[model samples]
Target chain A: MSRLELRHMRKAFGGLEVLADISLRVDAGEFVSILGPSGAGKSTLFQLLTGAEHGEGEMFFDGAPLDDHGRHFAFMPQRDALMPWRRILDNTTLGLEVQGLGRKAARTRVAPLFAEFGLAGFERHFPAQLSGGMRQRAALLRTVVQERDMLLLDEPFGALDALTRAAMQRWLEQMWRHHRWTALLITHDVREAVFLSDRIYVLSARPARVVREIQVPLPRPRDPTSAATRQAGVLEAEILDILLNLQPTKGHDHD
Target chain B: MASSSFNPRQLAGFLAQAAPAVISIGLVLVAWELYANHSGIKPTVLPAPSRVFEQAMLNRDALLDNAIPTIRATLIGFACSLSAAFALSMLVDFFQPLRRALFPVFIVSQTLPLVAIAPLVVLWFGFGLTPKIMLVALVTFFPMLVALVQGYEATEVEIGQMLRAMGAGRWRVFILARLPSALPYFFAGLRISITYAVVGAIFAEYAGAAKGLGIYMLNAKNNFRPDLVLAAVGVSAALTLVLFGLTVVLQRLAMPWERAAGRRAARKGPQA
Candidate 1:
């Protein structure tokens, strides 16, 4: 079992404060989403978590203070970040290869995952050969194949068209239901957060602080077509409202 | 991506694109022939196209003999430079101090006056193959080093970050992201260096060599046989074109993925 707890994490870039007294928890087997407006320092938080950037924070992993870089989370960027030169198969196996697994061994481990990721025939194809949605799936396959403690997906579906985004959202939900990996997703899309998350953390605009945490009680295999799914719409609206109406608390700053 | 299989349609398309270049070259040759026939210039100073052709045919064996050495020097020198660039670039990528020290030196190497250095190189090394090879290596090294450095730096920041986040070490990140991104740049640099490789070797041979196209041209010049000199020049130009074509083919072989991308862009270009 793996759990992540961020306690009073604060970050400043010179004189500009980014993460102002941020704290959140994602228990084991939980699928959490951090919903925020664009430029709300949503990405900066993930950057810190992935050790790409350093900031003042207390990140506890399974009740231990986090120090190791790659032990806890596998990261997926806003873009697919698939190496254009490598075939889709090699791209998916990249994480394993980086983890010191031999190329053949890594390939073998991730071979079956390509089919599950809806990329059966694209193994030999380059990143440019595939469509945007296919590339994202390959990237997701790359992330999950690492078999890390959790996944930190930063705007995974942010680059797709609306129709493709919806389809990928459904596809991702099905995959998540099957594996049940502890995951934290950072996104500006309220609809995406509502559809994919078990719980959503809303953040204010510039100097991001958790304004509220909303639990989505939508049951497993959420029927996007069902009348009961209106509950999701309500939650989507509520989070959207929080995001849309968020005012920069400049007066409360430096307190 | 396996462009190995040929088709009639592709051949037709290629020929269509190649038609203009062939026509332009043919027109230039025809115009030169007409001028040589009418100008009534001394053959020693300006041999007609026909005379140059006749001399080339008659001296084909000698030309071939001289050509082999020049080709060998060019290939060997280019290869040495490539390997050195690869080794040095790896060191530069890893060590900040090495990069800081060597980068300015590399630029200075490019700016060095080869005209003044060539005679000095011959004087030190004697009229053997060593100085010729050295000049060729020195001339070709900098483009590749610059290409490799720029290519490594141009790699997407997120790609490196994502790899490190996956527990990739510095070496792994390099081979995965940095190295591949540098391939296009490397090939572009290679194309530039390769063109100069042939020229550099010839320049070295001209400075001093027992047997080469450069020596052949010098002898022909002193003998008042301008037709022979033109024939040697023609041979060298043909050799350079062949080398340039080979680089393009090598680039294709190295990066089939870029070809795939190009095809996709081509297909989408009209509609988009």
Candidate 2:
């Protein structure tokens, strides 16, 4: 059975529909990427999946329907979104802290992860002290530390420079493989979608629908610079063409 | 770069910035002294700074005797104002309807000139500490309320979403996210309110009081003791400076991050 199922999910902001009749199933430990252009409702779909907004949908997690009071997924937004006042360690352990875990216990659990993530000495440093790449790593650590089966990431590496972004993608893939997590990533970068995802769901413009789902048959332990990885580049171009065609006319576009 | 050598240019720059204010104050004091001598102004009419200092020395015991009561009142009034304003701000933040209903009333209360209302407060509460404390709370509350509301409202949507995604409740979000972000605003409001606290207490004392700087000024006026009045004025100015200085100290302690940013800016020198 799939770990997460979104059946006919629909979301509208007043008269404007953002996600329309989107249905998909994510199996346990599957990595899926929702790719589209800007304002293509990829983030909106992530929001809907994670219950960021109430929408018409049937969402089941681990074969159980998600109730109003229960949470089954950890969500990481496009930005780092770290609490500026909190120390790096405290920020990473916030999810557990909110779950009624004592500070000592939460810190105990997060201590090893800090060393694993290359954040050992900077545990006491606040978010402002960290560089952009480090901040994103801390944010990812925060999401993962919650121990949720499904991780919903919205443009996680979209803000980084090209080199940093590539490094983060490789690091994230390593982390994902190590823990074997089910994740749904939203990104405007088609290459990112193809490289990171096992299967890619391409979303159309606002009032978005999944227009295409491309299965990535790339070999495991995918080397970013290898010729086999260049196959993913071909897939990226095809997705880009679809996204470009989906852009609305000037008069129809509204923020 | 590793050397800890002194920079003569930096010292000169510091002195250059301070020179104007120091010279301006000296000129003002000299002009006052000269005008008093030329006009044959009686010490009773408008005493020179020297005469004011002399009077301050002579009446040192008397000034201290009156100062204790006034200082006590000011401290009590300021404490009352701070607590009341904090609680009211929290209340306004917690409930939307209460905020909508009382915000306008608070604004309207501020517009009702304190000079006009001081006498009424004194009449209602008598010449005790109650009236003075109420007046200080009244004057200091609005700025703090406005500041706090704006600060609470300024919580970033991204941060709020992050907290929500972690399954944190509204109160949890507020306590963790909103409260810390609002610290600078609260400190700013406190700084502004500190000035108002001193003025409000003195104004209330002026309307009806037997002690305080305000009463001392009134007595000096009636007795034609201009030097004593000037001395009292100097004390009031000193009090304001002390309160403002305390705010700066509190802000530094509360927001080390801001101070770090400020130091960085200072090190960077002027930016075009």
Best by TM-score: 1
- N/CA/C clash count, model 2: 0
List residue ranges in candidate 2 displaced over 4 A: A68-70, A250-255, B1-23, B260-272
Error of 1 at B131 (Å): 1.1
Q: What is every candidate's C-alpha DockQ against the true complex, given to 2 decimals?
A: 0.53, 0.34
TM values, all candidates: 0.94, 0.90
Model 2 lDDT tens row, A227-246:
88678778877888877777
The docking quality of candidate 1, as DockQ, is 0.53
Model 1 CA lDDT for position B160: 92
In model 2 chain B, which range of ten residues has the least summed lDDT?
B263-272
Which parts of model 1 are misplaced by more than 4 Å?
Answer: A247-255, B1-4, B263-272
Q: Is the docking of candidate 2 incorrect, acceptable, medium or high quality?
A: acceptable
**For residues B81-150, could you state the per-residue lDDT of candidate 1 as single tens digits?**
8999999988998896998898888888888888888889989999888888889999999888989989
Q: What tens-digit string does per-residue lDDT give for candidate 2 at B1-272?
A: 12474688877997999899989999999999988878997877878888888889999887877666667777788787667777777777788789889988988989999879999999999988888888888898788878887788778788888788778888998898887878888888988888888888888888888778778878888888888988888887788888898888887777766644444345543211
